[model samples]
Target: MSTTTSTTTRSPDAIRGRRLGVLLVLCGAIFLEGIDVAMLNVALPSVRADLGLETGVLQWVMSAYVLGYGGFMLLGGRAADLFGRRRMFVGWLTVFLVFSGLGGLATEGWQLIAARFVTGVAAAFMTPAGLSIITTGFEEGPQRDKALLVYSGTAAGGFSIGLVAGGLLASAGWRWVFFAPVGLAALILLGALALVPKEPARPGRSGQKLDLAGGLLVTSAVILLVLGVERAAHAGAAWTAATVGAGLLLLAVFAAVERRAAEPLVRLGILRSGPLVRSGGAGLLFSGGFFGFQFLVVLYLQELRGWSTLETSFAMLVIGIDAVLSPTVVPKLVARFGNGRLIFGGLLVAALAYGLFLPLGADWSYLVMLPGLILLGLAFALVYGPLTIVATEGVAESEQGLAGGLLYTGFQFGAALGLSSVTAVAAAYADPLEGYRAALLVPFAAVLAAAALSLPGLRRRAEQPDAEALPGAGAGAGTEGGTPAGAAAGLEPARG
Candidate 1:
């Protein structure tokens, strides 16, 4: 009789190596996502000149992508769980590749915007699937922690690297910005095909279907919410308020629907996980504060100091140190201090970084700015990876895609809110310097609020003997047959 032991037991090194390959593939995809945005931002002037586009139409190129990405994220996450992680990831990646190439070939502004929107939708599906694969592939604890840290670091680095790359590519032609990602996406797709493992066959769910109604409500709500925020800087107050209010109403309706659905798109109980909830909140604040700060800094350097794109990129490149420290230093810190303490500490440091920069002077030398930049990088290294780990830690494997989606949705929404709020604040002031200083407060306050939000997690950690013993932690903890102990009951097979 053949035994299962021979097939199941592999050398530890082989497993480690395989997992490493998977991690690299996922990291590449995430890095591509990060870089894609930054590169496009840098190329906007060129794109406008080439297409003879108005400023309002040019802005749509970016806004279209954000709306598509944020709107469908939750649906994409659930789709991965229902369909298959590898299938969603691989399929959407192909879509991303195709659209990116189309974007490079576009002759008009509208065509480019359309291409970017579809690419963003593709990313919405692919990113969560990639994240879920890592969370489910690696066992919880040190191994998973290390993988996540490395993944997060690569993502952080991608933006910093993209700035320099965008400058170079834009010099060549704006089309190169779009063309570059096509090549990178192709490479990542090849690697994913070779490395990303297929999902194991399992028994089909009996009767549950995808919650189409719930998905539609949430997507509409999020799209409206993001659109309102994005337009806040440029649109009138009446329009923004109406859009935002409608979004809130739809969100409430979505919650009510979720409470009664037989197979809800998102299990509302997952939100009850204190760690996950806190992590998501913190992620929102962290992303908001960081992006807002970056926006102000870019304006200061480019508009105020008359710095070139390359010069600004190089100066800001110091902040990319998080990319290096995340993979190498953060794992050690997480092992010693725990994710909660580190997140708290990171927020504190981010607040300090913003505080240091609040005294911005028109004539200030780079030396004056270096401390704040360095601190910001350190804060990102500490916070970003830990937030990701905490968010996904307690979620069931089947729902990990959902968890990733929720975390990233918070991040995207926060970025939009932070940027728009700061932009509006800056525009209100007569003096440019005064406006920037006033705007700086937005991120500083946000970081402090995030620090406050993380306090409950630290308290919970202190009270629990085993950190993983928290109410929702069982799904991620050691379990028989690679499934969470209690997850089999409510799960229905996903419809293709």
Candidate 2:
């Protein structure tokens, strides 16, 4: 007791070095996940050509991964909670590396599809584990905020960079797209081993069996739901209806299972949180709008305008501005305006941009599209980080991985539905320009609906003290033995 000292001076260089190491490994994982998704999208056509995949089978190349990733996410997240985070992270990364290489070696369509699905499953486990580590490892004020901003910006960067990288790799050969991730995964694995700390075994998780029944029910439901939405564009109406109906039935069963489970894959009680519910809904709409708009724009540029892959990639690079703005500018805005107002405003801006694009012509220049693109990028920076904060802030450290998984599940599901629905709507019209205009309306309405949904959050925020009165609003506050003050403030409504 006599030797105890409360504080000691630490070198700035040592502190900075430690934080940088943590950020690099965490950001590297997120970046790889983002790039893998986008890279495959760009290389799909080339993959089909090389394998001589049938038109009906070609869509499965994308659909398989979506299904695997979306379906297994809950199980993955819960697994991270039960297993050590570092253990799950490194193990899953190894799985990802192996499968990505397998994908590159596949000569047949089904083999590639299988590889993609397995790789997606690996990512499902890896992503939430990485995110939870960052959320829990960094103290919950500015240090965590800065880390999150960098993490999110890196994610956006990976997607943008992948668009360019995919085009370049596909030009060499479709297989290279798959092989490239292998090399990146190996490097990331080495870095993770060197830098990511080993988490101790959780106090009570040693002997618990995974909720196998719950996992099966929920995974089946998600797989079916995604399949129905994805095929709605091309499959028969009756078939799509049957598939979606079955999915809903399974979801009901899953809900019942969760309520009764000894170790539920998801805690049903988490749904009682208003902020979590609102964030999930808004995330769904935001992701839907973003993905749908991208789908429409890619079709317009490449199919109608007859641009090469390289040209389309470059034209879309404007969205990468979110990468820079998110880390540098968004934190200041969040501190000033709070997450609710900023998310609301971002949605409205996105709505307006989509509306502005409704008047597109067959021969409209990239200059004409530039304004909407830039606005979309800015909106993403404003919205995505705040949305993440809202979703994960009040959550206990134990369940942060589950919360992250839920948010991403909504995102993947929304993206699947939005892209398919908009493509179907556009395809029904014979005139190309008419199709483009018609398609734009779907996302416009989606963004507007999301904005309307944000009203509850805004009203709740209004009832709280001004932002300046908050403990962590203007400065860093240490998280010592309890929840950060900012997190406590966010959890007030939930505790009600």
Candidate 3:
């Protein structure tokens, strides 16, 4: 009788040391990506002054990045799954690093806009790839939650940090903002290649071809949808309707393509799962609704209030501080009250924060806004982790990566789409402040929707067995993911 002994080989990233290294690399990538997203907004006036860009043209510099980031996010997510995650991650980081230099070197307005758009594409890859790594590397539950906090926190915090960094760099010369991130990216890429633990190929699945048709359709649909929302302001009422109609048509086609593809770009069924639908709803609300807040406030501070660029950046630091500590408290909340009451409570809290801003007039002090923004950040902290956990909970282990990517897709695209809609509203109304107030209500409506989506999951959880809380409902022992056993995680286990 011959019995075979099988050896298990793990990628460095799949282990502890490699995981830490990769985490650091991802943090850098996330920070750089986020910084680019916000950096341009902070320094737009400087760019306008330097390149002779008209005031209206300056908005394009910001939108160019958003369009690329939102449009291609899913494609980027697919790329990570198709190619090795590490290969694509390193490649994207390198591109972003290279382009920061290009953006810095831009001598004309169009040149800078083009460079910013390309950087957005590079960011598309880095964001998903980093998330894929985190989701693949960590197990579900508390451990994974910690990493998500860090990952999500970096994005939230980076939004603020970008402004600070942009101010300093812009003062030196607006180009340095581009130059500095490129250097850091190069360093992070090298470290990521060396330290990011790579997961071994799954036994049944390893290689697959790209769904080019699906990618193009999805990307184009997202871009057109976002643009139409923005264009509804001035493109004539009929053009607005047509643009939206066309966007919907492409999106419907993209859905069909995904459903029929041999290796579908998006796993449609997973997206429809109970937890994921709710999580996605929350992501849509927060990412879209909240994203516009900073964009509007930065303008209010710099242009409307006449604060120095650096001083304005310094003021928003409260959000990062609150977000870092907020998520850690979530597990305790879940343990005590369950997800339903808490999530609804959080959303209502966030709505209140945004609503408070509506009443502020031209003479209102920055101090008044600070408290509301802090409350908003705190509300975000409460909902972020639990919602992420719920999003992946109902799926089988093999599908976790796909779901992770999709949920994030909703997150990025929703925010981008939301911001565009709000911007159009503000611009159309011709009273930027009033427009901001009007837009504030949109997120409030969105949170109410998220609360509705999450309610079902919360009720469902009440009926599941305690063992179900364990990895693969306790079938998997000592595995990172909650599967039959021997599975690894994409990110850390869900925290708290």
Candidate 4:
């Protein structure tokens, strides 16, 4: 199914302006998603105090969202392809808006959790739709590259800025955190209605059917996997083991089902593309390391050092500098070094940042941690956009949403794994300081492994002919032999 926008007789400059409007609308939607999550995290303590909830139940406030998001993401992505990207995005954004407001007015703990879960599911659908729209709308070249860089930078900035916003809003009242997104979503929805172009009709899309069996199986498997990992730090060993083992078994079954299905929800062949696969792996490791590190930092500053939430937020705000650098600095770097080298370098710098912070002192000043924070921000600026470009570059337009789904699935699972593993390790030690020191190694090692994973791609790019090696060449040069092996068979290049 094609997602191309219909051509008009508008002037070139007019078309560019419309495309820019669409990009901004989509970026606003993503920014809303990022800040929504960050704001809720900050307000959790207030929710617990107000609702008088148990610790385990309070934790579910966050876990429910994660479960809903991670589980349904693959299904959501494929739905955009089979249904319509614009339809899915607009519909889901409305759902997100309503539910976010409901969460704000929630009088009971379960009410809030239910609202958050639905909101998360809405995001699972909306985010990929927005991303796929950008991928399909922009011609794959320098133009697409810059659009993606700006989109990613906005998302990072939202989360960073949300930290400060959340703290300030929570001070007013916890409900304000939930209410704030409502306003943002309403504005973004209006922009989307006005700016997002209508999807061109595909010849046979109306007759196409989604692989319901495959979708069900894969969704179940992902939900189980995410839930098992999330419960690992809290649940009993036997329970966690059984849950994860069952998830793996279901995944194997899902794989078998996809191979036999007449129209599989996911095209397994796309997984064979070397660059796509590498990008997915790198995304997983990078997110895992970054989030795990952030989690550890929060704990050390708040619990260990008795720092206020606002104080900690300010200290970590340095990492948000990526929001500034990604759209500006990284594009020039990508033009010179290509995505592969930049991703590798980013991973190495992240590892170095983690290593520099390995020493855990009770009385360490903010000055001591400042350099590491700056390095991490730079590393994120370098990695996030390039990884996104590599993941979707050569995939068929029909499966762009699926490609996005696969990438984000890795990121979500990696985050769950990293957070769970480190929490488990930290709990094992009697000495709090010693525990934090040991936990720090988790992110450090994960980043090093990510760097190692990127090496092969760099070497292959180095060996390629100069003409083939040009930045953005693989994306739009032509379809002759540039497409991935599976994509070359029947898939067509995306139409602008």
Q: What is the C-alpha lDDT of each candidate?
A: 0.86, 0.81, 0.69, 0.83
Q: Write the per-residue lDDT of candidate 1 for residues 271-364, one digit (tens) a residue.
A: 7677778888999888999989999998999999999877888888899999999988898888788889999999999999999999889898
Best by TM-score: 1
For candidate 1, the per-residue lDDT at 488 reads: 29
TM-score of each: 0.92, 0.90, 0.86, 0.91
lDDT of 4 by residue, 1-496 (tens): 2323353333221225667788889989989988988878777888999999899999889988888888889999999878878889999999999999999999988999999899989988998888888777765666678888889999999988888888889889999998999998999999988877677566656788999998888888998999999989999999999999999998899999988987889867766667777888988888888888898998899899998777878888899999999888888888778888999999999999999989978889999999999999999999999988888876666777887888888888888888888889899999888998999999999999998888876864433313322322454432323443113322222233
Which is the leading candidate under lDDT? 1
- Model 3 lDDT at residue 160: 72
Prediction 2 TM-score vs. true: 0.90
Cα shift from native, residue 243, model 2 (Å)? 0.9
Predicted structure 3: lDDT: 0.69
The RMSD of every model to the true structure, in order and in angstroms, is 5.0, 5.8, 5.8, 5.7
Model 2 regions more than 4 Å off: 1-15, 460-496
Q: Residue 163, candidate 2: how far off, in angstroms?
A: 0.6
2 or 4, greater by lDDT: 4
Pairs in clash, predicted candidate 4: none
Write model 2 residue lDDT over 1-496, tens digit each, in one string.
3323321243211225545776788788889988888888888889888889998888888888888888888788878867767788999999999998999999898998899899989988998888777666765545566667778888988998999999999999988888998888999999988877666444455777778899899989999999999899999999999999999999999999888888788888767656667788898899999999999999999999999988898888898888999888888887777778889999988987898799888899989999999999888887887887777665666667787888888888989989988989999999977998999999999999989887886764433222332222223322212544224212111110
Give the clashing pairs for model 2. Answer: none
